[model samples]
Target: MEIAIGVVVGAILAIAGFILGRSSGRSVGLSEGPLAGSPETDDHAALEDRSSSRESELNTVLVEAIGRVSAFLKTNVRKPLIEAGEAAGADELRERIEHALGALSDIDFFLEEPSMSRSGQSLVSLVENVAQEFSGDQDVRLRMQLASSPVRAVVSGPVMMDVLYLILHNASRFGGDSTIDIAVQAIDGRSLILVRDHGPGFSDEALQRAFDPFYSTSAEGLGLGLPHARSLIEQMGGQIELRNVSDGGAEVEVSFPSS
Candidate 1:
């Protein structure tokens, strides 16, 4: 009876030791082993991804909203100011205003239509006619060199008009009562318009920043003119660039893909 009781006690001790060792090994493995996917970790990763995506979407929406607002102000407020200036007996100012307004109107009209075809001849003629109408007393001279052959392009009329007017307006504004040389040429299978103004040229940084939305050097300017012009040109598969001439002025070059 004594031996049997000792044997039973020893057996019970061995069993307990084995269970304790197994339990310790399992705890250590759980602490040092490769991580297993859990609901909590998965939820955290998903939340982070969602947050990043939401932030990106919100930024996009904000940028688009800013653009729309800028457009509205340019059309409704800025253009009207030009018209009002014209009526206020400022002949030079009036001419500038009319030029700007006409360009804005053309852009508005062109964008209002969905499917529109534009004739290169008609566009060139329209621009020349408008320029002549507005160049009455301004010291700056207006000139147009149309292509020998009509360079047909698929464009929204108003958009192209706005682009042209913007370039012309900028040239006149900065040219400081000097003659502006306007020329049109065809190069590299693209129709190109060059507007050169004898004004204080901008630095490389300023030239680059001019394309940014709402960037302006003039305290009175709303700074949407160039950006809007660029948007219109790019919409029609064209490009606009500003470069300082070696003499002492700035030149704006616009290129349109040949249709």
Candidate 2:
């Protein structure tokens, strides 16, 4: 199933590249179609038109792919994974399902160019949800330090929730024998959330490439978690930063601009 999904994703990425290549005049034939034998100015004009059309076509392809992937995850992956886990009484099955769900969340945010509506969402509620989702199995302990007052951020609640989940998931996965700590506060009219784990601090290489897509320290990971979190936060007018604490841990700080 994983291989099948990888092939499908690879094909979609190739199609996207091909579309962009044609738009940029690399794959557009100069001697065959509308630009054939045309003067320089005419060729330029035609190319511009093709580029505009190609952009629209590319958006259509991305939207379609998003729909197909969402449907596939719901119908094929989620149900079977849940049932198998229940039948076999294995925690690993549930963990795999959660990881798959996280991947779907990333794809949903990374594609779909238009941002979702997230006006007037309570930061307090968002933080609560994130804590709940990550600790769903009741095994991982999360220490949430929330601010006293209500905090609101100008970002989609779901997007922020996923961001928190990704951060917490990473902290727990690498934390090993240490408890995870999360702090949520409002300062200077912005909502700030910090995640700290008492694990071995990131090495120099990790600090440089931690947020790069497909670059993972773990052999089994796809390395899209931090990248996806960063993209989603920036899209919503927020900022994310990662650093190692001086004492002994890795820290992730997320700031959402006030609505």
Candidate 3:
């Protein structure tokens, strides 16, 4: 009996020592494990990705907004201001100055407000605002055929209008007849706006690089219109396409998925 009791106690001590040794070794192994470095590495990578995404977003907004304001100044303000001075008509000059002030106020609003943020707005209203942009241009005739009812979409209203304006502006620039045709329709759960210009059709290279930033065929342009327009549209989960119509001009189609 004494021998048997001694044997049992020795076995228990041996088992306890083995368990304690394994526990100590396992604790050390966990700290030195292959996956121990993963958490920190993954965290660093995630931070980098977020930073890159934010930088890209800011760059897109900066480029597009600056381009938009520059074009507005050139087309709507500069020439008018010069002409108002040369003509020396008080009433006309006052009107032009007032218009310039209003446009400047709009620029301030665009910069201060979240004009590029997404929201639900009437697609028809957006298109109308784009058409209004050409109201002062005598040579550019703007026409729109919108749906009988209001077509709703989820997008940034200001950004969408700007994009449409850019497309229309480009069309007028290239279109030979100085006439712009805009059509809006809702089909297959999407809102589609088509801007047609009777200008010379795009060449193969132009078609391929229509959305390439800073690529312009004309000497008089900054070439950021289509690229900015495309970026805004794509950010809103929409699409913009440039194609030549068989009727001898180019057509730009803007489509946004309806809410």
TM-score of each: 0.55, 0.63, 0.58
Cα lDDT, model 1, residue 167: 71
Report the number of the highest-TM-score candidate: 2
How does residue 150 of candidate 1 score in lDDT? 59
| Model 2 lDDT per residue over 57-124, tens place | 77885665445554556555565565664456457776766766665555544544455687878887
Q: Would you list the C-alpha lDDT of every candidate in the order shown?
A: 0.62, 0.73, 0.70
lDDT tens readout by residue for model 3, 111-141: 2324568888888888887687666754688
Candidate 2: Cα lDDT at 246: 89
Tens-place lDDT per residue, model 1, 1-259, is 2432343344334334433443343223223333457656665555556656655654564454345444544664466565564246677666656665554443343233244355454445546755775476355677666777655556777667667776777677666646787777767788777888888887677787887544556543445567678877787788888899998888888878765
171: Cα error in model 1, Å: 1.6
By lDDT, the candidates rank as: 2, 3, 1
Q: Please provide the root mean square deviation of candidate 3 (C-alpha atoms, Å).
A: 23.0
